[model samples]
Target: MDKKEILDTLKAAQVYLSRLKSLDNELESAVKQIINTFEETERNIHDTFSNLKVVLVNILNKRENFLLEQAKKAKTDGLAPLEECRNVISSKVVGTNKLITQGNSIINGSAKDGLAAFSKNASLLGSLPEVPELKEVPFISFHVDPTSDNEVKDILSQLGEVSRIAPIQITELCEKPGAILVEWHSVENDDRLTDIQEFRLQRAFGDVIKEKHLLVNFNDCYRGLDTQFLVKDLKVDQPYSFRVCCKFEGIQEWSPWSLPQVASTSLRPFSWKISDDFLLSNENKIAKPTVDSPKVLYSDGPQFCVGHSVEFTFLEIDSSNAMLGLIDQILPTSSSLTSTPGNSFLVDKSGKIFVDGIEKCTRLSEFSKGLKVCFTCDLVNDHKVRVNVDCNEKRVTYDWSIDPDYKMFFVSQFYSPNWKILVE
Candidate 1:
């Protein structure tokens, strides 16, 4: 044979061998699973039968006791009349015997005594009534229903089979303020012909799972590309539990529900207004507003007035040239504080504070994550600009004389992707 033909045959043989191995593994797994299911079914049946036996025994014992009690009551009730008759007969016999003795005594006595005895006998005979005939009362009988045992047996035999799939489990759950992302996959890894075509996401909202009610049910159409779904529009600072299930496109059945994933939303600040001149990317922008807090604003130029003061807080500062301060000129949208043509105070990632292209503070502690650094421009007090690093109690104040012709506004510039701001 040719070498190419031999190589081709070898590859075909290898593919066939792999398929055979996979089939063998699948068959072994299926056999084990079936055996386990059969054993579980057998155990359940045995338990149910044992319980039934106990229940039936208790019922029969109760019935037997009840019947025995009824029989004793019947015997007592049936013998009452017979006992009264016996007592009456015994009293008559005693009276007759005494009368006979009195007669014999009178016969052997004198005439006066005989007359007295005869008078007493006549009175006693007139007072006596005729005796009634005695008969035995019939016994009461209890009859058992012939069909009851058969009915019970039928009920036991008609036990229904439970049809259910194995439970699925959630592999990962991620959460952000006002949003929750859920990811799950099937546990069985069943490779049936019915491919999963959709996922159902369910959510419950509350501090406790048992106390919570389902608030959302969403169906995500699956294209076999991703196993994750993101649920938005959730309330911040509230606890939520999520579960998901897989459904086939054409089939009506859905896989068993996945185990619930619990998470709570973080505190998200209010959305702020950005100036039209500055370009703001969609990334790192806060969407939802804090319920009780004031609105935040961002502008290309510093919003400075003679009597009014404006403050800006640095939510995040990742860039080396992230700037936040008052500017007297309308800085170019693309320029940083270093290139702006106005008085500007800025903080960098290296913990340095800068003003007008000059370093003012060196190695001051940088703001920690989630810490806010405030920049207040007080035009009322000789255009005094204050930079508070909100870390280590560091504060810097600058006095600048404003030109009457120039308009000043709050300015912020950050080139880093993680830079964020909130104006207060």
Candidate 2:
């Protein structure tokens, strides 16, 4: 063979050798996993059955004691009247016998006191001593259900089920400035049983996984069967471990949690980092108007980059103009948001949008209380950042001349007092 053919053959051999090595490693790992699973599953099963036994025993003992006490109570209650009647009859017998002895003594002896006693006793003998008549006595008895044993056995047979844990895995993890998006799926995707009821996602601060907080949906309940979820308001630039477990339709317990995956936010956790002449509280999440004049709010300065979004929720909006604006440079304390800086874009409650203080004809719905406004900066392989505004379910996109490398900050200003804005 030529040298080229020899080289090609060697390369083929090397490729096969690499594949063989990978397969061997996979086989070894699978064996180890199998061993661990076997031991762990066995131990879990043993503990489960042990607990079941204890519970069953306790139930049986409680029922047995209850029935025994019921029987004893029945016996005591039933014998009460019969015992009282017997005592009355015995008292009458004793009284009659004493009267008989007194009469016999009056007849057999010749004393005057005996005659007096006989006279007294004769009045008692005029009528026979009253004796209580015995009626039908109470019969106390307990009967067990004929089919109870068989019924208990049947119930025990159907009490609990043993099913293998579902293999749920986290498929994707995406990190944002203050959030992480997680997506997962079941490995055993059995289409025949579309009975997945819900899924639970838990997150811990570090890799130790000691304390975990269950993630809630926007409705503030545990997440349902959706495969993807975005956990927001997380601490930025902090490592968090997350795991997911699912509940099937008939399962009482959620399936075992998936192996934890760690993800950390970059840059900063988005919050209202600065405010314009307003009192900011709750880590700058809430802005309260301190002065009767117009107030402005600002997020972290120059840190808002591409692929990031800021949401503003109006908690209380008075009868005044609420403005949403963005600026690249730091605003001078002397400069007011109403002045509209030369390098800023704003959308006011009057439905007018402005670019660099120049009014644009784009009219959006007027802002109101309880209205959610989201501003997103997106640019894919482009120099200019595309700012998209979502308000009242209406979307308007604007391409700003600002370069993607040039970071900017979001601004919200209101004219009236008692205006509360929540920044996320």
**Top candidate when judged by TM-score against the true structure:** 2
Model 1 misplacement above 4 A:
104-122, 126-139, 145-288, 291-424
Whole-model Cα lDDT of every candidate shown, in order: 0.58, 0.74
Best by lDDT: 2
Provide the lowest-lDDT 10-residue window in model 1.
287-296
For residue 248, what is the lDDT in candidate 1? 68
Clash totals in order: 7, 0
lDDT of 1 by residue, 1-424 (tens): 8999999999999999999999999999778767876797689878987998899899989989999999989988877777787787788778778777777777777344566666666576545544445344645888877699788778778754453444356787665334666677777756642477766767666633344335343234332435776566567777777777766657677765554567875734223345332334443233222222212224533334342333344555553445555566665545556665666556665567777767874555665556555553344344343333344566666655555334455555555445555554
List the candidate 2 regions with Cα displacement exceeding 4 Å: 1-34, 91-137, 143-155, 159-163, 167-169, 185-198, 208-227, 235-237, 246-255, 271-307, 314-322, 325-346, 351-365, 368-371, 376-389, 392-422
How well does model 2 score by local distance difference test? 0.74
Residue-level lDDT tens digits of model 2 in 245-332:
7887887777766776788877566667654557777777778776777445677666577777778788887777678768877677
Residue 303 of model 1 has an lDDT of 39
